[model samples]
Target: MEVIRNLVQSLVIIIILAMFLEMLLPAGQMRAYVKMVMGLLVIIAVIQAVGSMARWSFEEIPALVAGTGDGGGQLPEILEAGKRISARQQELGIEQYRQGLAQQVTALVKLNQGLPLLDVEVSVESDSGSPDFGQVKEIILTVSDNPKQTSPAPGGTEPVEEVSPVTVQIGSSETPEREEAVPPQAAAGIVDVLTNFYNIQPEQVIIIYR
Candidate 1:
């Protein structure tokens, strides 16, 4: 009667503890593995209790529960694997978010029509512990008056256009001519648009002319 009562109490305590741990566990593939381990533990406890009632010795049960056996060593490895999987998922998610943000920024810049935006690059905070995690860090806009043609060729190589060098006078009294794909006003407007829409600082948005 004493053994039976103790077995029931042990089972109840283990079940309640498992439920509590499940609630604290993060959602991912790791959760399934953890649940399986917990279930195995419950089974082991029951078997151990039954063995005691039958006067049978199961020496390995305690070792397994204490995580001292070869099989028990796998638990740490499983946890490490879960952490890696979670980190990889986070990286993929951040990349997708960056791509989407770049597209949106490109579209917004195109609304001006004056600034020839070739491409947009977005940087984001990747540290999960940081307060600004997942937030945009920087944005770079590539502008060009003559955008590079990306048409495929039979040789898998695109033809390069040669640019003539400008002659500079050694002691010119007048200011040298400077070429810009996007004008000052248009660039400022783009910076303003991006800053306002993204709620980021103007300095965080950069424009590069090619």
Candidate 2:
């Protein structure tokens, strides 16, 4: 009877102290996390107190953890923590894998015309599979060129060069297609170069000038 009373007193004292200390800290996600930890601590303390009184053996712990025994109270919180950790790890792994593929594509693209591959977007066909290069469904490359040698106009002012962003779609259809939207100040030179060099139709080429 005295042990039970002492346990109750201790719990009340801990709660009062926590409440007083918590107010000294700014509230938000940090406060929420603090509360969760405190709750877990309370659960642990109660479980230990009860197990000691009942003379629980170590062998009973697995049954308790699986929620098959009467002492399975903490299993829900443990499962919740496991789920959150697993989800975050999966998110980080997928993003890292995608970035690695993009970097490899960028290096390979730089070999063509010595121009920069501004960005590469890749799509995978399979909804379920171990991530690998073979699952790639299509790749879109935003190709751009290096600055060229320019001369001043006869009037002593240099002509502004127009930006033509060529969007290339690869492996998306029966034949890979290219499209370029013409800017108001159209720079047909790059579009012409891509179309003629690649032996593709002019319409397959799109020119976006900026």
Candidate 3:
């Protein structure tokens, strides 16, 4: 009903504008056709407008007076639909986060496997219904640059030294050891990289056993 009313209103305005144009145009057969269409549109518009006014519901009177969208009670339905869409988007985001965490753990394992352990430190705690494994990890890899080689700079000064990349290896231990040792460090590193690189603190990242 509102659609019909708006359509009629738009048509009436278009016809009125077209009629004014016709009057300004030079008298010709084209003017005559334009005048005829304008008159027909005006009549149709008036009839539809009248029908819409007669069929208007009492509940719409407040909205019509307030000049809100559609002058109807459909706003609630639209708002509900928007809420559903928002909830669906949140669900998709959580699923994507889980998948990303799983991928990060897989990559970390592949990167650290079969490497020698320079220093070993072990800590263990059982889960207490929390998302985390209740273990904390902190490790610092000391890297050094070789002093034997020095390259000249453009200004006849010595070039800055470059530090060698350090590789961290976690040995293939028993399931219990791996489960206890690998999770804390790997999870901490994953969170650090994600937060520092992308500026997002993940809710939780679980390390899965292969």
Candidate 4:
């Protein structure tokens, strides 16, 4: 649609320029009417372009209103909540909390990019000697490209193949007695926060579990 409009605008300009050229040359009465119509169209095109550039057209008002209206009063509340959380973290000298929040944000970004949960991780800890710094535990999730499948054998029985599924694991002191299972959503959230902390896009991340 945009391409079509641009083409139309270019054609209008060309027609107007052609009309002006014809007027400058020796022309008949037919040229006079053509020049007048072209001049009017040029004026209209210029007005449309100016209006579009300024976003002053009435048709766009609804979209503008909708954009601003969706959040309504909720935007302030959300911002305030974020600010309060930030202030509290600074006040308490809790760096781990900030890290956790960052991990959560990364997870959200990963989810938006449609990355698997196994590609994400989260680390949280309590402050030690330093009032601000904390010992952190990381939960790493990684997705495996291979998966096990069973296929029919040429003779009789089925043949089995080993395949890999996405896996999530925790890292740090106090490892799970056994491999702990992580919820898909939790894994995704970890990815979200990590992405935000590193200021990188979630889709590009590949985490290796130790």
User: Which candidate wins on lDDT?
Assistant: 1
Provide the RMSD of all predictions against the true structure, rounded to 1 decimal.
Answer: 16.9, 19.8, 17.3, 16.5
Higher-TM-score candidate of 1 and 3: 1
On the 0 to 100 scale, the lDDT of residue 45 in model 3 is: 70
lDDT of 4: 0.52
After TM-score superposition, the amount by which residue 12's alpha carbon in candidate 1 deviates from its true location, in angstroms, is 31
List model 1 lDDT by residue over 1-210, tens digit each. 676787788778877877887798769889888888878887897787677766522444434444446444355665665677789899999999999999899778777644666668999999999999998899998887653322234367754654657677887789755555456888899899889988899999988776
Q: In angstroms, give how far residue 26 of model 4 lies from its true place.
A: 4.3
Per-residue lDDT of candidate 3, residues 28-63 (tens digit): 777777777767877777777666666665456545
> Weakest 10 consecutive residues, lDDT, candidate 4?
144-153
- Backbone clash total for model 3 is 0
Candidate 4 C-alpha RMSD relative to the actual structure: 16.5
> What's the residue-level lDDT of 26 in candidate 4?
41
Candidate 3 Cα deviation (angstroms), residue 7: 13
Candidate 2 local lDDT, 1-210, one digit each (tens): 665676677678767866776677657678778777777876787676666645554545545444456545466755765566666777676667666665665554444333333456654433335564334444455644333313233367755556656567776665534343322233344345544554455554443212
Model 4 backbone overlap count: 18
All candidates: TM-score: 0.52, 0.33, 0.27, 0.24
Runs off by more than 4 Å, candidate 1: 1-73, 146-180
Measured by TM-score, the strongest candidate is 1
Report lDDT per candidate: 0.76, 0.53, 0.48, 0.52
> Where is the poorest 10-residue window by lDDT in model 1?
145-154
